[model samples]
Target: MRTLRDDNILKLPDGRQLGYGEYGDPNGKPFILFHGNPNSRLLWGVIPGSPFLPGTRLIAPDRPGFGLTDFKEGVTTLENWHNDVIALADSLGIKKFAVFGPSGGGPFALACAWKIPERLTSVGVFASVGPFLPETVVNASPTVRTLWKYAPRLPGLFRVQMRFFAWLARYFPNLYVRMILTEFSETDRKDYARLKVADFLRPDRSEGFRQRGICTWYDAMIPATWPIPLKEIKIKVFLWQGKEDISVPFAMGRYIAEQIPDFEATFINGFGHFWIFEHKHMGEMLEVLVPPSSSPRSK
Candidate 1:
């Protein structure tokens, strides 16, 4: 429940500030948490309570302009975000830590691998977007347009396509939430609704960025276009994908897992997009990020 709002402002070289939250032991090694598109870090408590709280130090930050973070006037590219993450960790005096990227948080986590693998002990990616081909977008559901607004620059009629998506978010907010909610499994839906979904599930919660629909549109271009490719990364990776994932098709997850240089990929049949949040094995997941402390000998 503690947040960066109470902590000192973490300023990046470019002068942007990151909104972050810390849970569990402050002295413990850090594990920064990242959430997905249209979401703030509020998605973590969906597990009823974070498994990270007992011993692990979990730092959850809202993307600039998303949650409690100030959306400053600057380009919110992968590099900038990554640097901000680094700056945040530096501000906290953490030299090494693991990263947990879930859904939208996946891209930022991968960026951490790309930029600061030397400082990482482990990295876990959950159903994140990979290098998607533009052809996929051309053939994607109409929802793809909503995801295209944030790309570097879209010549020709791309802006017009973005207009349509903005229209949907503005006029059909309820329907948009339902469309997104449909991707979550039944239990995750209940868990999310009851837990931490409110800050991220509505336009009002993301009011500053609501009209700046470019972030979603920009997220679309990422799978098709990565400024820095994952193939160039040097980190060993672990991932969880659900075969039935609809939001981010499990097929995409499988594709990335196979292609990443050193990866351990796992797929759970019948599991869907939100399965990472729906997991009964999160304790194991946390163990990967924060290993248990050694115990004393018993009598």
Candidate 2:
């Protein structure tokens, strides 16, 4: 695992520095990974083992205000993120690549699909979030649903809440892990224990909140409107949704599937948001974009 960290910051044309992490084969196919809310690029390093395809290079970037990236207020929007992504890829001399968006990062993936489909080969979303509508909010888990519904209206309060959560994750990791497990399904809880994800989450989240919680508030509120035109996306999208997922409800995934012009969906029966990534689901998701010869086999 190799992270670009602060030393390898990619200086964008706009004078903003973007922090990123790189994993898997350095000289292989490129894939940009968009992490979920309250998370930084460090989330990719936390996966128990290297689940990325053998011939694949995974690059995860910290959105503005997260990790080592400098925050730009009033400049952060779904559409605006595409420009940053394009700049990142251009700087790497990568003309085209695949994109994978997980949880809160899903909308950004869609944003790329919509804004820069010509620069992408494929798009995949894992337990991805959807437009925050009344129906979607009502179906989501308690903690996330509340944040989604009220974050935009009460940005300051939600920022404080996210700050508290980040503090808990940093200082009291065990309690933070337990609190997160409460919303997952029974199967997910068992997998979380088996993987002992608690160990990695502390550092992953610590980096995510390196700039504190303001980015989280914006991440939570941005999905409410989905300013991008999903219907205009021409790239084929592959997605996996766990029926038991409450953190991002099944309905949200369904809504996304319905809106995409070309989408392939695998709706799992018993899985939830977190466990799916820890197991076979990730390998299966990767196979959708990469060639079979370079695909990874799940442990």
Candidate 3:
């Protein structure tokens, strides 16, 4: 497994401090990773070694207001998010890199493909957010489906809802974990049992609400906004979705694959939302993102 590095904060030209962390070989090929909603860079535990690719550096950045970064609140749009990413890359002296977004981060990855395709070597979106058409929203879990249907029109309600969960996560972490685990598929529950998932959830849950309540609320409201121009994306794209995923749902991934002009979609049979981050699943994604020079790893 790659050695975990401490968090590093970059002072952007705009004076915003962006928190990020690096994993794997520092000198290896760069791949910028965007975490899911209400999640920070800390969620990506560690990357195990793989044979198909030589080496890679995974860069995980906490979106504005999620971790140590300051929340931009009303100032954050898809364009603004893309600009922040570019600034971070420039500061790192990295001109080109791959972009990966697991869930809520998916839209941001697509935004990069749309706004700065020249700078990206490839784009990978796993269980990505899709267009908020009525049919798509219907496939989501009950709680998420309700939020997706009404959150845009009632942003205050969304804030209240997240704040409640935040309070639960802070004051009663064990209970909060139990509540959340109920939403996961059986496969994910087994994975959670074997790992310290609660530890990863605690910090983001507390800080995300305390520091950037509006940012969290607004990010959830993204699907209600204008549709991303996925068809315009020219960079190579990889889309992965699990058939049993309820948080984002399989339909969401299918929709994204249909919209992207250049994409390879992989649908796993029994996995759910959290399984994509597991070592086995992540290895598969890395193979696609960083194919071998002689012959690419087959899906």
Candidate 4:
């Protein structure tokens, strides 16, 4: 089992570095895990026991500006991410793979599905926001809604907020975890303590802040005017959301699901965003992405 300290770097054609963490069976069915905002590839550490499902090779990558990945300068939209994902897959000699996005990573996952559906075997998103319109922003958690309210109009103030978040994640890791936990529902909070999620999240959160909060801010802000045409996505998309999720409103998930041409969803009553990564829950997600008949046991 490799820890988050292990670094894997791949230099892309654009002269930027893409940093990723490879977990589970190296030769197993390839599955890319797109992490959320303010989290690095090390977010994989949050899964108790192994991060990947049986017979699934989990490739968790830091999107530009998070963790070891180089931050892109100026205005870059979510559409640009499929190129990186394709490049990474080609480098790994993977012809086809599944993609799972959690939280903010949802847009990137959808982007891949839209732009490179031929290369994708499966796609899914858990507790993620979609097409961050004014109505969508209204569905966000109070904290996130407040940030969305100000992030565009008050760019300087947003940067200051991001800097403060960086400081909190770096200097007060425990508190940082707790602060995030505060938004979780009571159901999720209990699982947080039982699973010791903060233990795994502390380092991941700290690494996410290594580049400070500007990248995270940009990442969070991109969906406001999503470039991907969800109606044109040719691949099937699976969605999971918790009605009790306060971090990302359940309606956001519903919005995306409705737009997707081929979509299936499972909305749980009591679950929350953070709790979806619980080992068993993640396993179930993988089961849907890659059914038992097609999946072989991990060597």
Candidate 5:
């Protein structure tokens, strides 16, 4: 995928430098995109002509330990994650904005909603991870279930595993890409084939691991303690789920929808975990989260 322009750096109060890339309109309504695990800000480049481009300033930040962002000490919990986001927004002079979280990014988006609902216009989660309870795990894909069950307890093992994958992604790019494509459902496979998505994914996958393989592994291994105060979120909340998603499981979305009051949940049949970035699905989500408005466009 082609790299986007306006890759900027923000120096936080603690002197940590945060790296981010700007997509779409620079002066448009701020819309933050939280990338999935093992991804960086560059992941946004994969979405072709994103609908948010019309009137939204899509901000993709390289989360701690990813891309050019430096990792901070004692910044592991969800609260710390949200605070980092808030700090970034403050540095950018943004008071309010919408947030979109896909896959592993889901929990971080929810953290923003939970911690700073007063500063948000809306929250959107697509193919997200819900409360990681026993019931959710029982119904999840074998790979997902096993990771959630054992990763935390075996962090060293998980790190070693990620390092191996990173080595494969760096050296045997084509084979590594094929290994990932093989995990998608039939519907996802069809979409991916038609879209030629692998080209866009290659850079992010390779660079993301190269920069923060250990940190990503550590973050993924941490267990999620549920009952996240979803009921307290005052901003508009939208949930998009793929009924056929094996990575997160449909049950996770259902559970989250039940917890959030007045939340809009859309379940797409035959879609998989990657549906959020698929052309049709992504268009639908952008329409709901960033409808074309007559309001003056950002400068």
Candidate 6:
């Protein structure tokens, strides 16, 4: 199938390479996008006419282990993820650009802010993460217990474990939804068909994702805590979230805004994890986060 948008390959400064797409003028102001895990270059493809597109040049790269990029079979960590992205920007001859990280793509953008704060116009997150997944859902939910029901080729013993949990959750459907809703509080409650399946998935879907042109994104499930060194970041910061989301919780968006000093800026409400389109105050959002073309620094 011909892609709905133009795509290209980017060779980084260090000899490593990756696939990417540049929307709008290549010479225009750079606005690089970072996609979440278990997805290819598709996540960044969603926003074409977003309020930010008219004036900003958009660049999105496939992460090392995700999209078409590769590294043997070693574990993929957030730090490695960050370096690979920086390499992508460097490859493009982009000294600095406004950075956008959505969902699992958050850490990479933050890492750039930390490592090269000067090369940033701003750092933004939409339905991104910072804290560990909650434990109550882990210890109590039957939905996660039966997380393997959709796995067909698993060994016999694993099937038993899955079936047992399925029996518990399936028979008591309420408990399953409750557990999953609690567990996925950041994304479970949002509108669909907007962000596409790229924003949400079941565990078994991991294998299917590879078939659709993405490596497994299970690495995101590994828990960790991190701070983005906000005090050192001099660029403007923006955050937005969808209230009904159940995957990364709107609270994190607020947390990010408040934690970062320098006039924490605006946090728009009612936009779900997938709701980056048609924002009522888009021009204002852009004015603040996208940097002013007339701003002295931009000059």
- Candidate structures ordered by lDDT, highest first: 4, 2, 3, 5, 1, 6
Q: Is candidate 3 or candidate 6 better by TM-score?
A: 3
* Tens digit of per-residue lDDT, candidate 2, span 168-244: 87788788788977776676787677777667666778888887677787888876756877778899999888887
Model 5 earns a TM-score of: 0.89
- For each candidate, the alpha-carbon lDDT, in order, equals 0.63, 0.79, 0.75, 0.79, 0.74, 0.52
Off by over 4 Å in 1: 1-8, 45-47, 70-74, 134-142, 145-173, 181-214, 293-299
For candidate 4, the per-residue lDDT at 101 reads 92
| Stretches of candidate 3 exceeding 4 Å from the true structure | 1-4, 46-54, 194-196, 199-212, 292-299
Give the true-structure RMSD of model 6.
7.9
**Of 2 and 5, the candidate ranking higher by TM-score:** 2
TM-scores across all candidates?
A: 0.76, 0.91, 0.88, 0.91, 0.89, 0.65
Clashes per model (N, Cα, C within 3 A): 10, 0, 0, 0, 1, 12
Point out the higher-scoring one by lDDT: 3 or 6: 3
- Model 1 per-residue lDDT tens digits across residues 80-173: 6777877777787777788888776788888888888987878898888766554323323334434443454562255465445556656776
lDDT of 4: 0.79
Name the regions of candidate 5 deviating beyond 4 angstroms: 1-6, 49-51, 181-183, 222-227, 294-299
Instruction: TM-score for candidate 4, please give it.
Output: 0.91
In the range 134-250, model 5's lDDT, one tens digit per residue, is 766555767677777777778788878877877887889788777765555667777777777777777876657755376567556544544357787666689988888766778
lDDT for position 31 in model 5:
82
Off by over 4 Å in 6: 1-5, 12-15, 48-52, 71-76, 133-190, 193-208, 211-219, 225-235, 263-265, 278-287, 295-299
* Poorest stretch of ten by lDDT in candidate 3: 45-54
Q: In terms of TM-score, which candidate is stronger, 1 or 3?
A: 3
